[model samples]
Target: MQTFVTEAVDWPDTAPALRERVRALVAEHGERDQVRRANSWTKPDPQFSRKLGKAGLLGMTWPKEYGGHERSQLERYVAIEELLAAGAPVGAHWIADRQSGPLLLRLGNEELKRRWVPAIARGEAFACIGLSEPGSGSDLASVRTAARRDGDGWVLDGQKVWTTGAHVSHFMIALVRTEAGSERQKGLSQLVVPMDTPGVTVKPIVDLTGAHEFNEVFFDQVRLPGSALLGTEGEGWKQATAELSLERSGPERYLSSMVLFLELVRHASVHRNPELDMLVGRLAAEAWTLRLMSASVAAKLARGEDPALEATMVKDLGNSYEQAIPQLVQAAVDFGSPDNEVLRAVCFYLLQVSPSFSLRGGTREIVKGIIARGLGLR
Candidate 1:
């Protein structure tokens, strides 16, 4: 049976410097509202994203020829964690910088690279992953969206639902069936569909907070060049799973409720109680543990290793930790008091959104099943 491998991660020596730079940038331009900062990573501010691009913080690990800074993976990790901790508005470029750009650099054709990579690195372009569908949530293999060859090009016809950042994205890297009559995981392919394509449509799905972060995207006979295909056709399952390892393990997974945690700390400082004290301690410890686990996965990625199981594990635990913070704080603190207004506001916001923490990367059931299979329990 396999087990999670934990080891001391040797983060880069440049980490401290990178953290300082990110903190300074965020202080000057980050979101200021406590409620807005609760899940800051999902807060879109195109101007702030542009500022990060100008600061050489985006695309830190890719080739300089592709407009990247050519920095180490851990350095990139440091920058992102600092951004999340400070409640920086990074959602505009989050998907692009986090996974899409890296996937494109790894798998895209020359034309695809030339057309999107540099723009993405500059934060002028944003991307969204087209994975979930109407009947398919985390079951990627159940995707029915299809692409067919048409005289040296491809025609895409399908719809993707619950796509985060779709409305703000310039393009989408979608998983679709390439070969006719393919089933499950076979014959799947990733296609780069420009959001501005003639037949593409994006409709916003507003959440309970009246936020338009999720979207439904429709591709009605969208046409693309052969070069739009990402990675090997019929091997999209493998490529996409690899991309998901990048998605599942990151600071963003655990830091979504960090602003609330900070508010909890502030409330504890003024209103000292044993219950609040214990809650804060427990949350802090879990946050630290999740940070270590996440950093370990990042280190493995830097070394060209696929720690899919470990990444899945980190995401599961991190999601649970983040999702619990608001609930715990609401129970421990007195929201009826006027002094706890900031804390009350942040907690309520997170309570509404924390349900999505486990759903986004992969649902709790799906993530746990992956873990069980990895351990030979399934």
Candidate 2:
């Protein structure tokens, strides 16, 4: 019998000062009520992103040569935790700072890194993931997007669906099949495809929330220079698999409804409802525990370790807890004293959008399968 355990983490003493700095920065974004910044990582706002970049809060872990501050990943977490908790608008730089920039620093060649990493760190260029497809939702190995080798470049001709922010992004770190006859997960290669390349089209995909956070991007004989290839040929599967550690385990996994959580607490306090206050306390405990679990995962990633099973665990359980926040808020308000117009509006919006918490990153079923495999149950 395998026993799963999460070791307790001792946060660095510097964390308090770092959090205060980020808190002061977040305070500058004032009037969160007007913006509704919940889940703002998926809601792009270039101006806000640029401000974060100028503040030197985006790329906290990378080398200073590429416009980074070379700060520890824990400090980065401090800044991001404060940003997400305050519902700051960070969507524009979220993907670039979180995944793409790091992926480039790890895999890209000198020229490729020099060209994109600085701009990414500066929040000058935006990016979107081109992994999911119309027919291949979570089964990424079955992606149908193909990139055929041309004389000195590649001609990509396929469609990538459910690409978040593709319509507004300047680039896509796409995974395409380079070897036509190769089987699943083989012959796959990662490429940096410029969105402005001719024959590339982006069709917006609106979700149930009446928001356009997804897009179906089509490549009709789109051409990319040979340098666009990231890492090595036929190695994209490995690169992509390794890259998901950040996507699945970060603070974003649990903070999707943080704004709503804060608002719910404020409403409960105003009414002095014991039941609602109890729910808030329970939820706060859950968030604190999950943060420690997630911080453990971050520590591993900082050391260049994947910790796949641990990251998957954080995402699966954290998303469930995040999804429940808005539901609990709605129930609390419905059963007790109602909230004012502002709190009610936040509750309704989070209630509408929280369903996606489990969908993105990876579904609960998919993640649990990984956990089962890691525990030798598969």
Top-scoring candidate (TM-score): 1
TM per candidate comes to 0.98, 0.95
CA lDDT for candidate 2: 0.84
lDDT of 1 by residue, 26-89 (tens): 8888888988887888888888988899999999998999999999999999999999999888
**TM-score of model 2 relative to the true fold?**
0.95
Count backbone overlaps in model 1.
0
Worst 10 residues of 2 by lDDT: 1-10
Predictions: Cα RMSD each: 1.0, 1.8
